[model samples]
Target: MRKDSEHPFRQFENDPGRHALVELFVREHCGKIKDLLRDCVPLAKGSFGNILGIRGKAATALGLALKEYPRKYESVIAPFAEQQRLSVNIPSAPRIWGSDQADGKDYVIMDEIPGVNLWALPQLQELPRAARLRIFLDALGIVDQYRKAGKRHNDITPSNLGVDATGDMRSFDPDFMSDLHQSDTDRFENKSVGSPAYMAPEAVINLPAGRGPHSDSFSMGATLIAAITGEILPKLLGENGVNDYFFYMLNTEKMQREIDVMLHEIIKDPVLLKVLLRLLHTDPAQRTVEPELRSELESGAADHRTMRYILDDYSPAYRTAVQQWEERMGMAGEQEGFMRTWLRRTAISCEKLIEFFKGLRNV
Candidate 1:
């Protein structure tokens, strides 16, 4: 039980205008200012607002999170609430209980989704490979839902995601949600409002035609990369690196090389690596849709095939020839075995092998 002063809403106390807005919001939607101050518990804080969880008589049957933002954001928050009201298929998105504007602020009361933030969960490295893949697919599915609804969450970072007890990934804090049906002018007005670390290359530069479903795909790729490697794109590049990658070096061969190096550090599955590279492409048009990516991931083809699986599919003579070639090349070093080197060099080669075997079988 923390004191009222410790609550995130108190941060606005020094500013008279925002302080008045907070008091108004608490009184009108929550209850008496004193009651809210005594019972409200801080949930999360963000650049746009402070989320407080209501308890006791003030809380709804299912519980609620009160988020307060400055009145200036009414244009964004108001529309988001309306969109949530109309949205039916996106269960991962927070359900807004109510929203109102008064004084100099906007307040939205929404369901308190139960879960731990995805970023705060145990490191991906500690989790089994299958679990890591599940997390990526689940997160991508959430993005897919938004895409199907003709909306894009401009901010898709790990902090805005959560995993519940049932292992389902949920998206929250949609302050930057954008409708794809909007005119170009409306879409680009707030193009730059997103987390820089996970922002798409187009959104980073405020490219007017660049912020669309593809941009969300780019952010989703970056988010998954961060979750997988535990290294954010900005931090991996060092100070001023995000700007350099998105602004100065965009669409250059050097940028491609940088992307390759980053992907190679953690991603080994050829299909996954190819998909992520496409998602992180400098050109938004080149990015693939989340549903297609999800389908590819779920199919067993995405899993790295073991030597035994390959051997079973091929002839013994072919395996003997491969062994002979490995022996001749003396490629059995502890650091780099023949198969490991082959897989690293031939990312798409495995696909080619499958095609060749299918051709032979057809013959």
Candidate 2:
């Protein structure tokens, strides 16, 4: 969830003229929800819709869509939620309580995330560096999980991620979820998927392919950049002012310059910088080269020796990040073992990464 101030739908509730419309909408939906809900309490409104927390026996929250059945909730939203439950940060996906049509509006109730989003926290920089790094690792873990599953979380941002009481992370947005239903042609033809600030260059420039795991990696890297520098990535990259697609195409050189500056400024560790650059690469293929990476690995020519090379010169800061992350994950005294387990489970392939870097070098 975003900050209340940035929540545009909140204004409609406060505006004397627009307030009636919101109330009418909520009232009609509430009628349907109350029939199936107990101890319901109004939470807040967002641009997409409003949310409510269910007390008593439910011990959950509800999300009411402002729009009509945009996609098949049972197919798209429901399954996605179930799978996201397997995410590192989120313990379980919010269950779809039910959906109903009222006054031509549709509403659905899903379990509420019980934690504070990263953006809601004050003074993130003040948190221990290890703590901050853990956040990045957690986000990375989410991306890695989805990538291995050959799925994608189209939108990822601090505001869309939450930290529960157990210090685990969760994804809060449901609208942009994609099951990659489109064919190759449709994927290439899809438009921008989520927030622009964290979008990858391919998302801005290329149209033949839609945002994928690499784009997720780029957003994760941007989150890390924000964590380290305490500055939004777009601002740090001097990509602040203009967001239209044309501006990105017209200023390719300028964008590279911004990336160079950002890489130099926030990332002191060479290994981390290298990894981040690869993640944010302009060439979508170069970023991860999903097709190539997966294919080459399957061929077994490179022997899956990619990651070892990239981590050959591991940075101390990254070591610390890894150690801290492992410890927080309850592998405090088993770093090596935990890493092995993690590597096996992670969708990110070091061998594939090596191939990607090699291709970059050859180019």
Candidate 3:
């Protein structure tokens, strides 16, 4: 833990120990996101960057937020990453161990996902189908499961979805990302945790209200479409245009049809197509189905572990963050969509899972 990796601001200069603590603070409740990469992937010790901001204050804020929103956000992702767990074949996160630490601080030891960006893809046409399928299934299962559960990933793009030399595709950007509930006018690290181009219109235009599950659907849609066509998604968009010209590139009759029709046909599976369509709906309210398609996508591949919130107990921190959020830039309750309901439900389920594991007697 070098001090350079925190923000570059001078405020953190005096407390490398605190910065380490802040990172560890987030890491503790987050489990070993770092270890996940170390155990499953490869990495080089990259050069470090400068520290920034007040490490102590940031650590305090994280603690407060965790205490506040623990129940709402715990089950959804690892502390440092956005992730979940479902059936084994579905390829979700793994179940955590040694929870109920009284101190309730789990550290994320893993860094971002391990693999090259799909955007920087290498030749893989000759790769074995089994290898590719592993990546594809893992990503698809999680995407489908969470969407159906009413959660939306703000960023789903080729860059976020990693592909190794084997041509496997897994979402690196997910697991341990931001929580929807804690989002407000407050000041925390502002990452679009979701992707930019892959995000649905609702996700992009969010301000009066936040985006929902469909936003993730759109990202998946774009990613999947790119997978089929083998074209860069960003290349299709124009700087001056608002319309999603990317759909037209599908080169199908459905692409020329209405927006709804276009959405339905983007993928061959009728069940998944419908879920995707609902996720892409402009009106979040009209799109409230738990998007099974995306979840199916993510879970179909790998079963990841849930080590972050469960052992760390950071939900209360999230809840407390609401008070810290900036006054409604008028973003609250501005738009009620099916996604909102789904998100709430998803958060609740995550909480339940944590409680379930927590309630279990010690070994």
Candidate 4:
């Protein structure tokens, strides 16, 4: 029986760009979606794709399509609920992977995330680079889990990041629908990986391992610099933006862009530079280790202290960001009854956090 659309998925059509993706979603999957998807409200679609609200396993179809790892993708997302471990200021539902419904065609299911777009960070020119970098760093943890399990993120950029009112960072737009194939099944990246604006220098060359962790790291660095500075490096670095990889690396003009001036600083910072540098390296073998990447970031913690005056400064965002990092890394303690029945669950972690820091003032 077609149950009343009481579940959250019904509300998904209101999501931006998702409506369009649904119309095209027909051919991608092997079979048809049983969910009676109503008309979806359209929003501005991203450069490559659209978004949609789906119930059951169909909700995750777009995501699972991006990479061929149906089973491992399930394996990677399974731990998120336990892994995110947010006490407050969290999203209502656990986005952690579990099957709600898969069309034999899709293979895995994902929960629908509600609330606002959570994409306001891009507009704030005064936001701290470190704070945004913090979000990207946590994102890396998720990416790391997938790679170890043999998965890849087809999209990585500021627009893909979701930040709540309480400043929680979550990943969305798992809709890499173009990568899924009818017969293929397993981890593969025949399609271009992630976005171009923040793509690694190697990405222009279409290297498989080109952007890996380092590529992600470099893009994160670029995102941070752009967020704080309102500047963007030439996506290709130089001629490499068009063709020829080795020559692009050796080109001096590529390194001298207005964006590169500050980018070079991050690329040079003792603690921060190595993270971005490894991501920018021409060879995949010279990747920056993830754990060590964050540590190097801490090595430059004082860099944020200078920017404490701005509304977007790291003063408060830094604290929340660190807790988020701890949550992603599983360093934070588990709560007694913290089942993510509500999005506020994430916020609860943040609230408890505020109290803890507030209490520290008296002590």
lDDT of 4 at 252: 34
Residue 257 local lDDT, model 3: 39
Which whole-number lDDT from 0 to 100 does residue 319 have in model 4? Answer: 40
Each candidate: what lDDT?
Answer: 0.58, 0.47, 0.37, 0.39
Among all candidates shown, the one with the greatest lDDT: 1
Worst lDDT 10-window in candidate 2: 1-10
Q: What's the count of clashing pairs in each model shown?
A: 0, 6, 94, 22
| CA-RMSD of model 3 | 18.7
Put down candidate 2 lDDT per residue, 1-363, tens digits, no spaces: 111112111221123422222233333445565454445565544325556554432121112222234333323333433433433233323334345555444556554443455555533445543444445445555676666656566667766665543345556664555543332235323444467777666555655555544667777666656655667777775556645543663466677667877787767655446556666666555555244333332342211122112221223332343343333334344413433443344333455445555655797
Give a tens-digit lDDT track for model 3, residues 158-274: 655653211233444344334444341221233333344555555445533445544555566567545544653444332223345433423323432354654444445554455
Error of 1 at 249 (Å): 5.0
Best by TM-score: 1
C-alpha TM-score for every candidate:
0.66, 0.56, 0.39, 0.46
Give the per-residue lDDT of model 4 (tens digit) for 183-268: 11222334443455666665555444343434555555555445444554444243334234334543434543433454565444
Name the Cα RMSD for model 2: 17.8
lDDT of 1 by residue, 90-147 (tens): 7777656556554566667665654456566555555555555666667667777888
User: Against the correct fold, how does model 4 do in TM-score?
Assistant: 0.46
Error of 4 at 301 (Å): 7.5
lDDT of 1: 0.58
Off by over 4 Å in 2: 1-31, 34-39, 42-47, 56-97, 180-193, 227-230, 242-246, 249-254, 268-275, 285-363
Please tell me which model should have the higher lDDT, number 2 or number 3.
Answer: 2
Sorted by lDDT (best first), the order is: 1, 2, 4, 3
Q: Model 3, 324: alpha-carbon shift in Å? A: 46
